[model samples]
Target: MIISVDHGNKSIKTPHLLFTSGLVESENQPGIKTDCIFWDGKYYSLTEKRISYLRDKTEDDRFFVLTLFAIAKELEYAGIKEPDDTVDVTLLIGLPPAHYGQLHARFEQYFLRKREVVDFEYNGRYYSIRIGKVVSYTQALAAAVTRFGELKKHASSYIIDIGGYTVDVLKLRYGKPDLAVVESFEQGVITLYNSIFSQCNSQYALHLEDCDIDEVIKGEPTILPGEVQILIRKMASQFLTEFCNFLGERSIDLKVSKCVFAGGGSLLLRQIIERSDKVGFPIFIEDIHANAVGYDLLYKSEVAAHGGQ
Candidate 1:
């Protein structure tokens, strides 16, 4: 089976499942073993506390372990329960457009293991699977793959992926990326989170997490003080303004180009982004799993072109 994964700094996503990028490892299984996976004598569980940004995700096995979790979740979603046979899994993954050139090859090699088959346990069920080909694609543009027919009508379009740790911008002229203009900026939603946390701590003497601020932005009823919620909305708007300025400094005039927004941050700040005058009316890819879904689509096209490679 071909399974695609979009490993974001804030979350890990598959076509059927999405979870935090956070991982908790333990030598022994915990008493409350919800969402636990056991592999190589170690226990791993998903957590909301995401890891710090890493320039190279292949530097450690953390991401690899997370990939295993993703695969297990995909299998579970497909109703492939504790089968006796070993399943071959061809994983389709992706990296930001800016990182594609330098890291794509390494990222593919990182998932290849010496052993032909591996066994792991998830939620008390065993899974035996072999890792086949690991394919990597560019991130920002991947989410826009399915809409190329529509995008081709435009002379120029921009895919602005507002992710957890980086805002990846890809300029596509006539539905294909202009490689020279593919860029990733460190100013992502995480920066806004940090800024909000700092300001809230100093002003209101209350520290806040992303979830707290998210509630405020979504206009969801919560226990937070109204003043704090107001501050969050205010800062979120300012963040969008600063983001527009950052893009402007790079000569990216969103006003002149058709823009498509993707990733979790874009969805969270949908209203705020729509309210910004810096951009023309933009199309937001509300599905957080768009990248993963795109990866699957791209992989299928590749396979068909190559005659079922």
Candidate 2:
């Protein structure tokens, strides 16, 4: 089986399952266990709080363990509660274009454990899988695979992935990615969250959380003051303007190029972006798992290109 996983800084997404990237590790089993996995003599439980931004995910085993959880969830979704024997698996994963050159090789090797098989227990069910192969691809460009036909009609198009910790941009010239023009900006949704939190703390003396701001943006009922909520909307709009200006500073004209937006950050700022006259009629990939889906498509194409590998 070929499983594609998108390791976002905020969440871990597979074609079938999406979970927070946060993992709570403990030496002993948890007293109240739910969505817990036991691996390598350690117990891990999924949580809503995300891990800190990681430039290099393979610096530790956290992401590897997250991949285990992702695979287990995918298997369960496929009606495999517990495998009787080791299952051969080809894992498709990705990294941002900026980091792909330096990290893709190590990222691939990180999943290919020295042992032939990996065994773990998830939610009281045991799963054993052999890593047949691991393929890593560029992240932002992969999300734009579904639009290749439309993009090829134009002279150039830009894929703007507004992710959790970074806004990664990839240029597609004549429907093919120009790797030379890839850029990653540190200003992402998380950065916007921090900026809002800081302003609320200073101006209103309100200690705002990410969820609180999310509620305001989503037009959900919240206990926050109407004034604070208005402030959030205002700042969000300003952020969108600044983001467009940043692109302009880099000589990227959204009006001239077909700009496609993807990733979690894009969804969060969708309204603000759409309202901005500075942006053109932008295309949005609403599916948060678009990258994972693209990775799957890319892998099939690659296999077919290699004559069924």
Best by TM-score: 1
Each prediction's total of clashing residue pairs, residues at least 3 apart in sequence or on different chains, is: 0, 0
Candidate 2 lDDT trough over 10 residues, lowest sum: 146-155
Q: Over 4 Å off in model 1, which ranges?
A: none
In angstroms, how far off is 189's CA in candidate 2? 0.7
- Per-model TM against the reference: 0.97, 0.96
Model 1 scores worst on lDDT over the 10 consecutive residues at 109-118
Per-residue alpha-carbon lDDT of candidate 2 for residues 269-306, written as tens digits (9 for 90 to 100)? 88777778877868999889989998998999988999
lDDT of 1 by residue, 1-309 (tens): 889999999999999899999999999897885798899889998889998988799988899899999999899889898988999999999998888899998999888775378798988999999987888998988898967888888878899999999899998899888876899888788999999999999999997888998889988888999889889999999999888888889898887778999899999999988888988959988789989999999989988999986
Judging by lDDT against the true structure, name the best candidate. 1
